[model samples]
Target: MRKLIAAGAAAVALAAPAGAEFASDPAQHLMRIERDALETVSRDRLQRLMRAAAEADEDVVRVSYDGDWLAGQAAPDGGAEWKCLSEALYFEARGESVRGQFAVAEVILNRVESSVFPDTVCGVIEQGTGELYQCQFTYTCDGAAETIHEPEAWAQVGKVARAMIDGAPRALTDGATHYHTKHVSPRWAGVYPRTATIGVHHFYRKPVRVSSN
Candidate 1:
């Protein structure tokens, strides 16, 4: 299974688009600051910081590749692929078991399909109100210090992130958008339909009721 997963990841890397836009531009440097601030501060504050970073570093906007300036764009950033996936795993699952970490990623993707959120993985993860506490994932809003001292676990999570980003079918959570540890039951869990249980986490999906008259 591990070999298959690794092979699949490599294939996706090879198949990734070669367009320069898919390549990481300096503007994405702003995301690095945003992600860091999200881990330790409020999302609204992070947005303000991002704007400041962009304005303070006019060179970031003037960064040109060959002769063209790269702005308001996104790229695969294969060089940073491992780092990106590793950070996602750490922030999203540093508290969960291994399987539970992957499950969290699954739920994030599921929200992409629903009408309630944006249609991209990063979008879903970062969507939030002005307040730090209002977001899809609590980690993004929580003011906890982000650190990864466990190298082994980080490697495993990196593998999972690579797989999911590479288009591995989300076979675990089954379109779940909400989940919580077994320690407590949130009020919404009682109303939503239980989907799947992976590791210590309980997954849920919005309920759809069908009535027969």
Candidate 2:
């Protein structure tokens, strides 16, 4: 009876599956499972990398300095900041060329960066308001009503403002924080360093004050 039982046990061992070695050793089985999982993860990672590379190869739209380019763009809309900037450009620079409009926007944005001026677009534009001839932007304190009369001109400046607020390069102005029309030479024009002259505007960078102890 003992010999018959041993023969049956050996027959069962011979009939085990192909991975009997792994089945017999728990550590080996766990290692095989981990290796398969790692392989699957590596395949997934490779697929993601390939997809990103393909996407990177697609065309990207960029800002252009031209009238046709602005006209081609869809009408833009934005929040308070955009409205303030658009209004400023509309009133101050509606007659300016597209390049000139961007230059004026650069001055406003540059002022926002300077410690001397308000940090926000609206704040910078509205500085010194409520008094005649006291505001930073003349249009704000000019006592004239601010209204959007020309849809075409307003739309053009709206696009300019949007492009500027969306991180358009300020190469046109050379970091100008102040600008005036070519017709008027303000007292400060001689004080600050003139950086650029674009269209009808002359751009200047405010001089840094030095203190003598």
Candidate 3:
């Protein structure tokens, strides 16, 4: 805090005019100028801080079903893990509602937190990749190209993935570590307890920890 204040003060002082009046009361004149500089910097800094707070408050909002909130965010530029999460959302749940997309992110993240799954998003999502039809996520080994054709949709889910990675709440999934689309009923779904039903997917978390391969 002190560093910020000092930097703000220095910036205000440096930006001020170099010329000074030759006053008879030189000491008082210098003191007054310093006081004015301090006041100006403090006021400007406070206003900037307040505006930043307001903007940040607006940036993160409820993930709406219509995807209205996504327009406010850019596609996240992150590492491989981020890309993996975004891709999973793109192939698996991009057409889902915004809430549904976030719910999927939540399930992936929840699995990361579980002892039964890999400790990272990519590790969990791409598990069982070498064995066809054995992958945790179908997109990884379904023999189809993992190409992303929808740039806008990718950007939206990228924002969702980044938000989830940055500690966004997982309220929708209810601690689910597994989910499958409504079209297919995997045998595992019957074994695991249902936690949520978001959009076209049914979510579940295993009743007990299972060994991760």
Candidate 1 lDDT, tens digit per residue, 134-191?
8656766786655788875666666666556656557677788898889888899999
Give candidate 2 misplaced runs (Cα > 4 Å): 1-61, 210-213
What is the TM-score of each predicted model, taking all chains together? 0.53, 0.71, 0.68
Each candidate: RMSD to true structure?
A: 26.5, 9.4, 10.6
lDDT of 3 by residue, 60-123 (tens): 6545445666777666878988999999999999999889999899888988988878998899
List candidate 3 segments past 4 Å from native.
1-66, 209-213
Cα lDDT tens digits, model 2, 1-213, are 656545554554566587777445544455566689999999999999998987864533367889889988888999999999999999999998899899999999999999999999999999999999899999999999998999999999999999889888788878899999889999999999999998889999998778886
| RMSD of model 2 against the true structure | 9.4
In Å, residue 19's CA in model 1 sits off its true spot by 68
Which should have the higher TM-score, number 2 or number 3?
Answer: 2
Task: Choose the strongest candidate by TM-score.
Answer: 2
Model 2 Cα shift for residue 198 (angstroms): 1.2
* lDDT value, candidate 1, whole model: 0.65
Worst window of 10 by summed lDDT in candidate 2: 22-31
Mark the regions of model 1 whose C-alpha exceeds 4 Å error after superposition.
1-85, 95-97, 208-213
- Candidate 3, 140: how far from true, in Å? 0.4
201 Cα displacement, candidate 3 (Å)? 0.4
